[model samples]
Structure formats: structure tokens, C-alpha cells
Target: MTVDDSLSRGIGPVAMTVLPQAAADDDERAAAHWSGQLATFGLLEAAERHFRPAAEEGDLTAVKCLVWLARQDGREREAHSWLERAAGAGDAWAMYELGVSLPRPEGLEEAQRWFRRAAEAGHALAMNDLAALLARAGRREEAKDWYLRAAEAGVTTAMNNLAIQHVLGGDRAEAGRWFERAARAGHVDAMANLGRLRLEAGEEREAASWLGAAARAGHQGAAGLLAELPGAAEAAGEAGLP
Candidate 1:
């Protein structure tokens, strides 16, 4: 399969080659690979062997991998230890992941702190997530700021969510603008929502374009909505997309 196809959907067998199964007397490298495999395959106990040694040895990458797997297994305390090591090693992604896995109190203060650190280190998704936390806590102005930053950083999901926030806040104009921005960036939900909005406003031609965009981008709900439109099937066939 092409690179785009591999990334466009769920993980496949070959793409999950980060981990391998361990033998009775696996070497360190084999053990590490096996551990990765165990995590990938959801064999939590079997994966521990791959992570434990390198984590104990202060290997940042291993600590990150183990921490992520531990979080998936709900072993938060162990994940915390590994995350601390990786965070201390200056891994910004580790800080972001650690923030997400930790428990929250009083509106994600701890998570915000770490997300801020990661954002400063140029982690776009962390910036978006941080914006969401801020928005949930009623820090709309600050949230908007972070959303703008993340959107500029090419995070299309952030752009779409930010547009939703604008819409929720009764700024349909701003929402439409941002929705268009995200749609151009290939955000499927943005395309669908924007299309729906236009349709509601009787902008049939524009709605058809956006709905087609959404369907081509694999938004199933948008595809269904498109099917409900007059002559939509013909439009979809003529588009020659998806």
C-alpha cells in the first residue's frame, strides 16, 4: 500500500512491526522489540519485559514507549515514573503524554502546565489540547490565542474545534471563516459542518461543494447528508474524487 493509504486509516499488520515476539532466550534488542510488539498487540504483561530494563537504564525513548503503554494499561503510577524520566530528559512529547495520562484536579492545571511546556517546544497537538482545556475552564480569550497558534502550526483539527467554539459562542461568521480554513486543510468534519450551514442558509451550490469535499475526505455523515441533497449522486460522480 501507498504511504497515504497506510496513514489514512487503522493500523495494519506490517505497519505494526515496531514490536516483535520474544523467544525463550531473546537478547536485549529482541526483548525491546518484543516489548514494543506486546504493547502494539495489547499483550500488556508480555510487553513489560521489553520496557523494564531500558526504563531502569534511563533510556528516554524506552521510557516514553513504556509510559505510553503503561497508561494504556491503566498502570498510571508506573507510567508516571517513566514519564518523569522522559520528561526530565527534555522530551517534549513525553511531557505532553504525561500531562494527558495524569489525573486532573481543579480544571486541568497540571495538564496545562505540561502542555504549555510542550507547546513551547513546538508540539502542535499539545497546543490544541491545551487550548481545549482552557476553553473548558472558561478561559475563552486564552483558548482562542492557543487555537490560533496551533492553527498556524498546521493543526487542522484545532482549526475545526476552534471554529466550533466560535459557533457555540454565537459568532457564526467567525465560525464559517475558520471552518473554510480547516476545510481547505482537509478537515472532514469542518467540511461537513460548513456545508450543512450553507445548506441551511440556502446556498445550494456552495453546500454541494463543501459536502462533496467532506465526502471525498471520508466523512461518512457528510456523505449521508450529501445523498439527501438534490442531484447529489450526480455531483459526486462528476467530482471523480474519493
Candidate 2:
């Protein structure tokens, strides 16, 4: 990946400059709530002034917010500490986000701990990410179990990944079933991949539809294959099929 993309992935999206919608509709408290954010955004002095009080008062939301800021500011140590505190306090989302943020080896172990905690608490993405990590570490059976957990929790990425695993394991039928689930959930890569696999199995009509769906979703390879279908070859000036 490009440096900019890599950095963007590591840091997450830009910080929101406003309060959440729930906090906004409270007419009386909205002003006070936003005043703190205004301070944070440089409209007032003491940027963290609003966040500090909430954090000190042990507000989980405030702790999460502070951790987000630390992540944005590249303060890994502070973020790590805050995440540990929140995760220990039974914040599944915090545990999952921390799992996603830490480094490998040490980070991976830490990530697994938080992910396992969050997964047990019913965090879908944590289960999915943890399954991916387990698969990468060559624990395929355990990974499949985690993938099933994430799939049960409605994680489409886990569905797609599990389909690939099935395909690699020579269980094409099962793989197709998972691909169908992922495609129905609008996973573009899964649609494209399933389209190709279907075509290889001589299910051209279904493959074309899937390829068309994937192409419409901006998968360039799918678009290319869709362009090569039947009459499309003639449109591209190729000779008739043998």
C-alpha cells in the first residue's frame, strides 16, 4: 500500500468536529456539550478541558473519546493504557478497537486477549478479526470456529473469508454457500470471486449476473470479465468461439 493509505489505515478516519446526534438534540445540555468540543477544536483554549473531567469521573464514553484522541495524536502508550483500563472495565468495543490498534507479537497477543474478551461479549468485528489472525497463525480449525462465531454474529467479511477457506480445503459446495451469504450481504470481492468460481464450474448465466453485480460495485476485474461475455467478445473485435 502507499504510505498515505497505510498511515490512513493506522490512524482511522478524521476526528468528528461535533457532538454525536443523541447529545445534540438535548437543547439545554447541547450547548455545554458542544462548548467542550469547541474547546477541543481550537475555538477555545484548553483543548482537552472538556474531555479531562469526564475521563477523571470514570465515564466510559469519555475514556473512549480520550483514547480516540490519543490514537489520532499518535500517543500509543497513552492509548494502550486507556484501552486496558476500559477493556478491564468490561467495555467490549474498547477491547475490540484496542485489539485492532496494537502491534504484532506483543501487539498480536494483546490483540488476541482483547478480541477474545470482546468476542465472548458478542462483538462481531472482534470475532472476525481474531479469526483472521488465527488463520494467519496456521490455526485453521480454531480459525474456522471463530469465523463461524463471527458469521453467527452477522459479520460479512468473516463469511467471505470462511468461504475462501472452504474453497481452499476442496469443499466447493460449502464454499459456494458461504459466498452466497456474503454476496447477499453485498461483499463486492466475494461476489467477484464467486462469479469467477461459478464460471469455472460452467454456471455461466449465474456467473454473468454475479460478475455484473460485482462490476457495478466497482470491481475492475469483474468488469473486465463481464465485458468478455458472449457477444461482448465481438464488441471487442475478437473472433467467434471455436
Candidate 3:
């Protein structure tokens, strides 16, 4: 509710650094690909270098990248132009990004429309976002359905969120199953939550195991909780949880 779950997929740009040489070839599509790589690394200036050429050449991804960069620079008007350009061209990522970028108060309805457009286009991230919004609006059944669709489409965050919904519904076993599914996929939050659940159930050993893995994975909350367990540090090290 606070912000779009950019990290899950779609318009979420990854923080990266390396600029691939393969993406720098004479091909426009290749250049666009490189621009995305650069943008993912938070190398906006470098990303923009490639974005201009690719977007000018009509590369959809490059257009989306330009939108992302403009937003990062606080150029909302510029970003909107790029968003409109890409969306008009049927770029689902652009539609999804535009939805995420909309200003609140007047944004929710418009964002929902954009999300439906993108989701109908087979955008998994858009589906998940729409599901969250539906959930927030207290439409549990519809939210559950969308979450299932997204989770089945391999959105790990959807798996975690679905588990949360299960908890709210008092379906403890279902929650545990989904949490484990997400944790096994390397979801730190799911791992931590599962650890907490096990601890609450008096399954300290299982709790320590999950907490150890989440902690080694650099989840600070998991680490803090693990530290309070008897011999947890030594046990985690001995178990080679990392």
C-alpha cells in the first residue's frame, strides 16, 4: 500500500553495475537491452546514453527505461511523456509503470485501469499489484484469486502475500505451506515469518533452522531473532546454513 512492489517484477528496475559488451553492438534491440542492464544497476547516466538511441529507434524497452530514469530524476512530466509514448505503442511494462507512477487521490482509479490493461496482456507483476489493491479494498475472494494466478505464474512475492492472507483467514496450515513454498524459493521475508511461526508453535529447532538461513541471507530481523536463541550462532555455523 505504501508503494508499488517494484522488486517483484515488471517495471521494477534492478540495482546493477556491469554494462555488458554484447548489448553495445550495432543492433538497436541489443542497445535497448544494454540500456536496461545499465538502468538495473542504478547507472542512470550510463543508462541514458543507450536509452536515447534505442528509444529514438523505437525500442519499447528503451522507452520504458527512459521513463524510469526520468522518474528517478524527479522529472514527472518527462516520465509521463515517455510513459504515454510506450503505452500507446502497447508496451505492457509501460502501462504497469504508468500505473505505479500515478499520483495518489486521483491515481488509484486510473492505476487500476492501467493495471487491468497490463494484466489482461499477461503481465504477472500487474496481476499481483492489482491483487494487492483488491485485498486492501477488502475484496478477499477476488484478491485470493489474483494472488493465486500471480503465484502460479511464479511471482514469489505473491506466494508470501498469499500466505499472509491465509493467516488472516485463520488457515494456519495453508499459511505454513505457502510460507515454506516462498522460503524455499529464497524469499527472506517468508523464511523469517516461517521461523516466527515455528517458534510460536514451540518448534524451536525448526525455528532456528529457518532463522539461521534467513539470517545468513542477510535478513537483519532474522539475524536479531536468531541471536536470541540458545547457541543459535554456533548452531547456525555448524549446520552450514549459508
- Per-residue C-alpha lDDT of model 2 across residues 83-194, encoded as one tens digit per residue: 7777878888777877887776778887888898898898888889888988998998888888988987788999999998888789999988998898888899988888
- Candidate 2's TM-score reads 0.73
Q: Give the per-residue Cα lDDT of candidate 2 at 42.
A: 41
Higher-lDDT candidate of 1 and 3: 3
Query: What are the lDDT figures for the candidates, one per model?
Result: 0.73, 0.71, 0.75
User: lDDT of candidate 1?
Assistant: 0.73
Among all windows of 10 consecutive residues in model 1, the one with the lowest summed lDDT is: 19-28
Off by over 4 Å in 1: 1-35, 38-59, 65-76, 103-107, 168-174, 215-224, 240-242
TM-score of each candidate structure, all chains considered together: 0.65, 0.73, 0.69
- Model 3 TM-score (2 dp): 0.69
List candidate 3 segments past 4 Å from native: 1-33, 36-75, 240-242
Q: Write the per-residue lDDT of candidate 3 for residues 165-201, one digit (tens) a residue.
A: 9989998788888888899998999999888788888
Give one clash count per candidate, in the order shown: 1, 1, 3
Better of 2 and 3 by TM-score: 2
How would you encode candidate 1's per-residue C-alpha lDDT over 50-154 as one tens digit per residue? 557876887665565566467567777987887777777877877787678767675378888899998888878889999998898889988988898898888
